[model samples]
Target: MEFAKPLPNYLVTRYHGWKATSYQENKGWYRRLATEGQRPRAMVISCCDSRVHVTSIFGADQGEFFIHRNIANLVPPYQPDGDHHGTSATVEYAVTALQVSHLIVLGHSQCGGVQGCIDMCKGHAPQLEEKTSFVGRWMDILKPKYQLVQDIEDEEQQARQLERQSVVASLENLMTFPFVDEKVRDGSLSLHGLWTDIGEGGLECYDPKLELFTKV
Candidate 1:
């Protein structure tokens, strides 16, 4: 618990420095966004990783994206009390509350969560049971995708392929939400998959035809 003091010190110094300029100039914008209303047109389901910041990468200000971040940006299939319900709640809010037109499931390169999923599937990590850690249970959502990408000969290519496949899986899981399914069927909602390689600054879009993430 003593280590927790470092977080407060970090926030008081590092966070203050980052927010000082923005808060001085954009105070009104922040107040309005916090008090009035939020009408974000898109909902982005992304990783909780600090490096894969969707808003910063997309140049979106506050109230632009109804954001939800979880391990590996994975959305588990709809099931009652399945312990992976955040994705469902976020999708519901986006479709029913905010009525967002676009739902983006963003994946990225060198994802530790996705790598955990891969390792679990390969029997290198502990088995998924009731006592498994949250990450273990959460990353279970990407197990199938990890298995599908297992045959690649190149290690780097395989990691990229695993991330891409997880994106596709999460997109499918998006449709499991009743509201999302109804809207997609009625031509009101669209789901997109994006893979961002932070080191290379490359963003790719998932191609349905080739079943791959092609550079955008």
Candidate 2:
């Protein structure tokens, strides 16, 4: 039952290199973090895309941010049906357990997940329409928001709009959780939406009041 495969050699080599250099340099910091446990100030929900490095973008260190990555960075509405809910569990732990002051939904340009949602909604992706497609079901969370950007004539513009909308959609879903809502109402937690440009290195923050993303 245990025979399968081993980790790739490249990963093992990199781990050894880190253990020799970065790990040794920050050994004390890592030990302290291990003993004290994580008390991250903020929790960032972002896409699983490898290019979206939240830590590098924010220049953060270990134990500074509680980060969760998933396809499209989506948060489904609260449903206490006694089912497995990974994102919901993460949010609950971050807000109610860790008491993180900030909860950020980070979106980015050229997001494949958002583009898949657009394609599925436009009836262009038949494979995604299949009920057996896990990705299709996951992208369903953002399917409704496609209507907002459907009118844009340019494909690039429409994709960009939907990418930003994904962040807003996640933020909206986060509030549906009772614990998250309670903390927000009590001024103990704050929600934020951010969209970044991978090629241009541009960052924008959403303003709930202005109803738009502004450059930071």
Candidate 3:
């Protein structure tokens, strides 16, 4: 298509460099992965935020995790009459097709998507309230949880609370899928909620028993 653009020079150069070094060093492994196909043990649903590096956080190697990224790392409640459900489709593939044992919803502090939801909820960003705004509609999935933090007098604290809530909310929504529900109930699949502090490099996992996020 005439509309398609070429890769930027820097990215093209980086690709060539990686091919010559990393890819060559792991040529045998890459060949095996290409031949055998992937069998990632875990599926990680995380935000599209550029700073949130899902692999770097865990020091994971190639094909270790099946990763899906979306704004706020959300998983919408199951809707069978699907028209266009990207997140839902990925979850279906990960759970039913890939048979991934663990599904983790990863959220982060200072998340722009979470902050956008906060702004939209507080009526500070009128443009987001319009139906034509895709981000606004996506943020609606987390709108209800805003009520949990709105009364907080501190803005940073409020946003931080909602960030964690996003992870918890997505984990709940993941269970809404029948396949996920059945597997989780049978102890075949597990779900996790995690939040990361970007600047401090701290990670916290939600303790379902304590109903709070404890430092990792």
* lDDT (10s digit) by residue, model 3, range 1-216: 899999999999999999999999999998999999999989999999999999999999898999999999998999989499999999999999999999999999899989999999888989999999999999999999999899999999999999999998998898889999999999999999999999999999999999899999
Q: Given candidate 1, what's the lDDT at residue 145?
A: 75
Runs with alpha carbons beyond 4 Å of true place in candidate 1: 1-7, 14-20, 81-84, 127-130
Ranking by lDDT: 2, 3, 1
Compose the digit string of candidate 2's lDDT tens values, residues 1-216.
Answer: 588789899999999999999999999999999999999999999999999999999999999999999998899999989999999999989998899999999999999999999999889999998999999999999999998999999999999999999999999999899999999999999999999999999999999999899999
- Scored against the true structure, residue 214 in model 1 reaches a CA lDDT of 83
- Which stretches of model 3 miss by more than 4 angstroms? none
The digit string of per-residue lDDT tens for model 1 on 1-216 reads: 655644578678877876888787898998998898999989999888889979888999889999999888888887867554667877788899999989998999998887787777777776543365878878777887766778887877888788888889988887787878999899888989999998988999998888878888
Q: Please report, as a residue range, the 10-residue window in candidate 2 with the lowest summed lDDT.
A: 1-10
Give the clashing residue pairs of candidate 3, or none. Answer: none
> What is the alpha-carbon RMSD of candidate 2 to the true structure?
0.9
Clashing pairs in 2: none
lDDT of 3 at 145: 94
Rank by TM-score (best first): 3, 2, 1
Listed per candidate, the RMSD to the true structure in angstroms reads: 2.6, 0.9, 0.7
